[model samples]
Structure formats: structure tokens, C-alpha cells
Target: MSDQEIPAREPSWQSRRLLSDRLDWNLLRTFLVIGEEKSISRAAARLFLTQSAVSQSLKRLEEQLECALILRRGPRFDLSPAGEEVLRLAEEIYGNVSRLAATAKNPQDDVVGKVRILTISQVQSDLYDDFLIQLHRDHPRVELEIEVMRSADIQSSLNQKTATIGLGLCRFPQTKLERRRLLRQRYAFFCGKRHRLFGQRRLPLEALQGENFVSFTSDQLGGNLSPLTMFRDQQGFTGKIVASSSSFEEIRRLIIAGYGVGCLPEHLVDIDLHNGLIWRLPPAEGVVDVDVFLMWNREQRMNHAETVFLDSFRRLLEAAGEE
Candidate 1:
């Protein structure tokens, strides 16, 4: 029979077995890493593999599946339709594998298995390194998967059981979640060195009236009308808001550019204050204080490793005067 006219035959048991044996779990893992990072180089660096190896593995995975799973955009990788399906399946498969590993581990042995954490982006920048260092020192076998996102995203992840723990400013009560207060975060009003209030050690709240202001909004703060409320209700100051942003970095930059006076986390502007890049304005009343919290779902049962990690986090917060 001509090759084109020949009928397609179903694979035998032996052929099916051979194909199954050819499928590599490592390649699937590499694919998942690439999906998460969205960059081959980043995925390679995270996996501790050469860029070429990651590329080759991705190619192999696509070949084994007989379909393209990823598409390259201008400077980033995006999932194809097949890739989306694969990613969903891959997450479930890995989750099952993790559960199995956790179950198989000896109770008396070292704490092990992965802990997923969702935290505010700024909090991660400030505290993640210390937390990771301490966690590694205490339990070398434990692995951490961390996501730094907006506070709303963090809370959603916790509620959905996609994340094991969450840490951020808590302004609203969430049902079915347990919250542990970590610390009170203090905010300070600051002006750029070139601003009118720069030389003043502290300005009366009345002096701020009619001046320009910069504002920052965060999901963690929920609807707390902070600096405005402090100024209007308490201080009786009326200032025009010149700029607003969701990013604290943007707010800091705007303040540095002398756009307007802005309130910022004391920790974030300490160096700037010391260097005289920014000057703090003492409010006569109604200073902003946000309580930070470590939260987890109440319905979820904590494994030993998770319990230990939570304790460690609490201790760290206490030491930092956050708890």
C-alpha cells in the first residue's frame, strides 16, 4: 500500500508502554518552572540548570506531547491553549506528589515538604530574606514557594487554599480565617528636601493646608482613608492631592521629585531621612498606625512543618516588634 493510503493502526500494549516510559517527569517539572517564571533564563537560573538544558527540555516535552505548549511574545513567553491545559494538570499532579511525599516522610525525621506563602510585595522585599535564612537554618529540608502580590491577591490565595500562609496589613475581617496580629506599622508624613517644609523639624497641621499632597493606596489597607482622614477630620487641614499611586515606590519617587508631601512607612524612608533627602513632618494628632497580621485559613489542618514554620514566623515578628 502507498504510504498515504495505508490505514493508521492503534498502538499495541508494548508500544504504549514504551511511549509512557519515554515521558519524563523532570521535563514536566521544567515546563512548569518555565511557565511560572515566564522566562527561559530565569527558569534555568531558578532550577540551577543551564539555559541550554532548559531549552532542550522544553523542546523534548513539546515533542513528547506532539503539540506546541508555549508561544514566544516580544520579550516574554505565554502559554498556548494546550499549555494552559497542561499547566492545570501539572499543578494538580505536583500537588498530589507533594502530599504523597509529606505523608511518606518520617514523623521523627527533619521537617520537610513545601510551604507556599502569599505576602505583600513590600513586606517580601523587607522581610523575605531574613525569614528564608532563619527557615533554612532551622529546617534545611523544608522548601518554600513564595508569591509577592497585592494584599487582595494574598487574601484570595489564602481563602482558595492555593497558599499555606499569608502576611500583610489586615484592615478587614475575613470569615473562616484566623488572624494573628504581628505588629503595628507606623507611617510618617515626609517632604522632599527642596519642599517648603524641609527645614522645619515639625510643622503644625494648619501649615499643611493648601499644600499639594501625594497619596498611596494599598489593598491591604482596605478602605482606610488614612492621611486624608488624619488631615481633614483630626488636623482640620485641607490639601490638594497632586498624585496618587498603588505603589509605595511611586509615592516615594513623587515625593522626592517635590510633587507633594506624602506619607510613607517609616522603615521605607529611614535611609532617606538620615541622608536628608526627605524630612518628616510631625502631625499634631492622628498619626497613622496599621496593624500587620499573619493569617491562615481556619478550616485547613496544619501539618507539622507548617506549624513549625508558623511558630518561627511569629517569633521573628516578635523580635522585630511586629508581633
Candidate 2:
């Protein structure tokens, strides 16, 4: 990819000491607000200052930096080259300061903010459940919003910084994301009660040849769930896929409703297997092992609740791993 042409900036800084002596935190904060709001009047309203006062702050910041911070006309506003760089640095500074405040809070203090999690369906695990239960008991004021999304959509959301956390299968390691293995799940082929092969045990690998199949949309993506697709190919199943879905529950419903045999997380189907609603199929020995990951955008500036919850959750994961 070609590099984007940046707006020309000043030659170079003369001395770090000189720059630090003249720079004020308030000026940088005001400029950051102007860059975000894109309007002097709006920024003044947010900062609870007069419009002229805000304009003076920006002018002071530009003069001290020896470069134009914002290029503004009668009403239109835009960030100059130096202004863009300053805004980024200012955001980083503020994020660190915010994190420090969250860190220094008393343990008894309430952590109050929302954490939006974009995840794939059927993430049933003891560790995950324990995390949630512990989170509620410790930080009752923290709010969580969970949304079930496709693997592709989850990745997109995290990249755009629209979602805070992601949990599920992923295609490959995204450079901007931080990931940890949250669970190692076993996947197995299963048939509904009404299927002819249901309840069968020790069936040969050839028995499922040309049998109809049901699966998740991700299975066809060539990225996520590559193991399931590879296993299907290795088993020599040439059957047409009768149904597919992005949701695990929907795929499970279709398979249990007798749409076709499908691969699902083994632990999630324990109750169904016990009740004879679905029966595990052949090749019982070499089940597919898929690692579910906990992922978040490295660029995102998380809220107080997010910072606290993740810290506690990581400790829980570490403790579990040691056992």
C-alpha cells in the first residue's frame, strides 16, 4: 500500500527541555477537544468555557508548538499535521492517566461502566462461568452487554473499536488484537434421534459417506473452523450440506430437528446426549480440538469497568491454569 501524504509539519524540535518548559497540559487538552469536536463552539460547551476562551487556548498551543495546530476558516475546522500528532499523543497520555486512576481506587469502591462483548454462540465453559459469577460478586455496579455475532463480524467490530471484547474462534492472528486461549473444546459429529444412524456406536468411518450434513457458516469460510472442514474432507463425506447458520444454537437446533448430522462442541451437547435427543457418531477416537480465544482490540481505550474486570478475569485464568 502506498503511504498517505501527511500535511507538512515543522522542521524538528530544537530541545526536549525547551518544549517541556513552554508546554501546558491545559493547552493540549483543549486542542484535543477541538480536534475531536471539530467545532470551537461545541468544544467550548463541552469544556464549559466561552468560545473565545477555547479559541485562545488553541492559538496558544499552536504558538508554543511553533506550528499550526488547526486550520480553521469562518466555520469549518480541520487538524493540521502537527495538530493530528498532538491529538494522538494527548489521547495516549489521557488514557494512561485514566488507567492510573482506576488502578489506585480502593478495592471497596464500585467500578461502574459498561463492557460490550461481541462473541460467537454456545461458549459454554466452567472457567467463563466462574469469571462472570466472580465479576458480579466483586463489581456489582459494572454492566456487561453481550452480543452474539459471526466470527467475521466480531473481528470487524473489534478492529473498528466498536466492541470491547471478543470471544470465539478466529481466522488468524490480527496484528491489532490481543488474544489468549480461553478454552480448548472438543468437537464431535452427532446425529438427531430420528436419523437412522442415531444411537449407533463404533461405526466405521465409511458409514457416513454421502450422508447429508449441517454446519456453521464459518465452516465454509476457509479460515475459522478449518479443522472441522478438514475433518469432513478427511472422512470423505461428499454429502450436500442441507442447512447452515452463523449461530451455534441455530445449527444445533437444525441438527436436533433432523435437518442433518453436524459437528458441535461435545460438552454443550452432554444433556442432549444423556436424554437421547442426539447421538454421537463414528470416529469417536479422533475428535477435533478447537481453541476458543479471548480477544480485545489493543488500540481501544477501555473504561474503568473494563480495565478492572479484565484484570480480575486474567488472575482467575492464571489460577485455573496452575491447577
Candidate 3:
């Protein structure tokens, strides 16, 4: 119970570079490569090292951090929560380092930084494509890193300042973020080739009542796809709700597989319509349209590259409006 019996405490932040002095930075680089390749052998191949060497480096990192970075069992390979965080930080570090190296190689007054854009899956935007092409042509020094994610996640990234910009469905207003409509995607019901209602033309509203339906996981009242929910209600089709997913691709696949009638963005299914995989159902005018917006946290300080890209996108949008 004496003061000398107490264990020595670890040094705080006052011990400058104490922890950093002992950490091997190469292990972090090795771990980053491992995460990207998702295989120790592949990472080793890329690093021009042996598989055992790469594995040992990962083990060393885990030991130093006091947590496992990855879960490897049988044929499965995945990141642990701690691993995910480390990987994220590693990626940010690499991205910034890459930008710095590029700037050093080609010194210029040009915008030179990384723009991180988080967006929802499968966004069909001609304007966005044009903007990317133009940005590359105008500011080759600026790098763009895009990641696909859920709409809600996109907002979180924007609000948290992790993402420089975002493209997604706006479920509710976030006062901290500035938003502008990028595109409006229209939804229409479709039946699969094997469905009983396939190829049916101009069916009355009452015909859809009591019919089974597959839909987006967010297609509920006050949800991301609330417009679809409102339209389904208007038609008196209560939606038996056979299955659901957040992914539009899965919903389309299930509808094509004849699980139930489902809705998809009309622009996204032209190939399916042409290939006879699915036929458009009732409501010739189409049901509801969801607005996807280009959003960012204007209150946050943006790097030169991010600010340049945002202005470029706004200019493109304005020119489109003028046309």
C-alpha cells in the first residue's frame, strides 16, 4: 500500500517523440500495401519481398499497436475494427504523401492536392463525367480520389470533413452542409421476364393492389427513397415487401429474377429493357423522382485542389443550365 508499491505510469504527450522514436514507419507502409492487396502473398509480391516477411511485418505492427489489424481464417480475409482505423489513417497518409511528392517533382502555381469525393453507388451523371474530364484537362496536378458509399455515409463524410465533396440523395437537411441539385433520377416499376405481369401495358392502379414487391431497403416512409414509398401508397399498393436492399443493383437483380415487381431508375435500366430482362409496368408517366445533390461543408477549410474542383463543378453546372 506504500507509494513505492504503485507501478510506474507511462509518459504523457510531454514526452515528445518518445513513441514515434521507437515505431518503425516501414511497418505502416507494409500494412498499407497489405490492406490494398488484401493478401499477404500479393502484398509481398508487390513489395518484392517474401510472404513470410510481409506477414512478420504485419505481426510486428499489431504487436506495437497492441491490437490485431486483420482477421485471417481459412480462405477468409478481412480487417478488424482496429485494422480498419489503421488502414484509413494509412491511406490518408499515403494520399497526402503522394501529393507532396508530385508537387516536388513538378513545381508549379497550379492547384496541387487531393480531392476526396464520397458518393452513392452507380450514380449516372453525364455532367459529372464531363466535369472529371475537364478537371483532368485543366488541372492535371490535382488528384481526385472517389469512393462509393451509402447516401447517409456520404453526408457523414462531408460533415466530418473527411470527404472534400459528395454526391448523394438528400434524405433530410443538414444545416452545416451546402447543397445543390446535381440530377433527378426517375423511378419506374418493372416486372421480370417470368413474372405474371410482364409485358402488361397501361395497367390500372387497382391492378397493383395486394401484389408482392421487392424494393430498396431505404424505400420507406421518411426514408431515403420516400418518394417511391409515397407513390406506392398513392397507387393503393401497400407493398407486401418481399425483399429489400440498399443497393439498386440487387433490387434490379431480384426484380429480374422474378422475386417480385420492383422499381429502378429509368436511366439505369435501358440495357435491361433492350435485352428483354424486364418490362416496364403501370404508370406510363413513371412514379417518383429522387434528387441527388452535389454537397460539401462550405464552413470547413478546403485545400487548394478541393476548392478548385468545387468551383470547376459549379461552373460546369452553370454552363449546363445556360444551355
Identify the candidate with maximal lDDT. Answer: 3
TM-score of 3: 0.70
TM-score of each: 0.61, 0.65, 0.70
* Pairs clashing within candidate 3: none
lDDT of 3 by residue, 1-323 (tens): 22112222444664434657777788988998888678888899989999889888988777666566777666557887778998888766654554453333246646787788888888888888888898898888887788887788788666656567899998688988888888988888898999988888878867777789998988888788988888877777865999899988889889999999888999999999999999998788888888898999877666778888888888777788721
The root-mean-square deviation over C-alpha atoms between each candidate and the true structure, in angstroms, is 8.0, 10.6, 7.5
Q: Model 1, range 190-227, lDDT digits (tens) per residue?
A: 89987988879556767776678888665212353353
Q: Which stretches of candidate 2 lie over 4 Å from their true place?
A: 1-110
Residues 1-323 of candidate 2 have per-residue lDDT tens digits of: 11111234564657445888878889987876777678889999989999989978877776667767766654586776777888888866654543443334446766877777888887887889988998899888777889987777787667656567899787588989887778887888898998889877778978888789998787864768777788888767899899998878888889889988898888898899999899888777645888888888888888788888777777777788821
**Candidate closer to the true structure by TM-score (higher is better), 1 or 3:** 3
Q: What overall lDDT goes with each candidate model?
A: 0.72, 0.78, 0.80
What count of clashes does model 2 give? 0
Q: Which stretches of candidate 1 lie over 4 Å from their true place?
A: 1-109, 124-134, 219-233, 284-286, 301-304, 311-323
Question: Which predicted model would earn the best TM-score?
Answer: 3
**Can you rank all candidates by lDDT, best first?**
3, 2, 1
